[model samples]
Target: MSLPLTAGETRLIVAAADAFFPPDGPIPRSGSEAGCVQWFERYLALSDRRQRLLIRLMLAFVQLAPLLLGPERRRFTRQSAPARIAFLARASKSRIYFLRVVFLSLRAMMTMAYLSDEIVANAIGMKADTDPFGLGGQPPLERMVPPPTPQASGVRLKGGGPAVEPGLGDVG
Candidate 1:
């Protein structure tokens, strides 16, 4: 087996992995298949501040996702394989940001598989057809929905209009 991971490197990798896989979907293969664990390990060892900044940005991006998407977060978290793979294929700066946060989160290493998927998907142009937020041609079900409309009561009884006076209807 390869040498053990350092504490900081392990922390970063785990965090990146957790955000990659939600509760549902196919269980990804090991770190060797993705090669990101190695990438991460090598990356963490470096003293570059840019990586640190990218990681910070990624964490904020992920945390904001919950608020920005709202109810849709549940569905996005359980996305279809195609969508999941598409998101993973791309390894852009955005992916790095995601990876950094997940690493910090200290989630399971298994989750990293999904991140690898996204990086790979992105590189192969899968992201071109799919938007990270599922905005681009994605099915309506996965898209964010407008808040429910407030029901309008035609009887306009605001400001105590005596709609329910003391003996209005068969008081016992």
Candidate 2:
């Protein structure tokens, strides 16, 4: 499905994904080639309006960050691959929590997009054997037990004394 992002925004996402998950080793395609942009588009489409807006804002920041933070003031998409990678690496180490969060979030998305491909999984010897019936072993959710909820106790006052009930004290 078509995403809500503008053309420029879409280009930026593609470029960012490519930079974050460049094709290497046995991998034959970059994140964008593995359909990262399409995955991101679908994800945004499924998200709530607020979430979509926040994701868009994050992408915008990622796209513009190179111009603001890099030694050379250039757009992220226009930067060379090495420059892009360096910018992201620096952002990942930023002292600002928001910058680090944004870098981590983008890295996660890029990794997810790149590694989720069946070809990549098979190439990495991680492809699961297909089971037509419901015989792929029990799902992990079936083994989980809900934890018991803790009961609330009355508040304790200072000095290690039991909490006094209001109006229950001796009146002299």
Candidate 3:
């Protein structure tokens, strides 16, 4: 699949995934080893416009954050593995709520993509396709939607929305 972001964005996300999923514990596969980059690309494509924009902005901010916060002035992807790990560690413990939120959100996004992989999900003993509520088993009913408000009238009817399945909407 064609990646929409710049090369630097791609590398930075890969770097983040590496830091977030280092091979130090119960997890058997590294994020990259689990094909996190491809998963993230699919995640981005399926996101609504606003979600995609927010994720892209988070990636851009995190890519440059090492320069401002790290001991050395370097882009995130250019930093060594230890440096990348330290960067995320510091961001996670940052006193500033905004910094913590940014890094944590990025971490969640990457983790979601990583575990969606078939091998990883099975290794972790998770039934990735379990949708207990059955909400998405069928197409939404015509009468299920409430009357759209004046401001949000067009949002619900948009076609090609996010995947309707319960897991790994990575088919994109």
Given candidate 2, what's the lDDT at residue 53? 82
For all predictions, the C-alpha RMSD in Å is 16.8, 8.4, 14.1
- Candidate 2, residue 107: Cα displacement in angstroms equals 0.7
| Global Cα lDDT for candidate 1 | 0.46
Q: Please report how far candidate 1 places residue 53 from its true position, in Å.
A: 2.8
Clashing pairs in 3: none
Residue 54 of model 1 has an lDDT of: 60
TM-score of every prediction relative to native? 0.27, 0.71, 0.72
List model 3 lDDT by residue over 1-172, tens digit each.
3348778777987788878887664788888788878877888888888888898889998989888887868988989989998988899999989899998899888888788878888887988456676666655684487667573322433376633443434365
CA shift of 129, model 3, Å: 4.9
Instruction: Return the TM-score for candidate 2, rounded to 2 decimals.
Output: 0.71
lDDT of each: 0.46, 0.78, 0.80
lDDT of 3 at 120: 81
After superposing candidate 2 on the true structure, give the runs of residues whose Cα lies further than 4 Å from its correct spot. 1-3, 24-26, 128-172
Q: RMSD of candidate 3 to the true fold?
A: 14.1
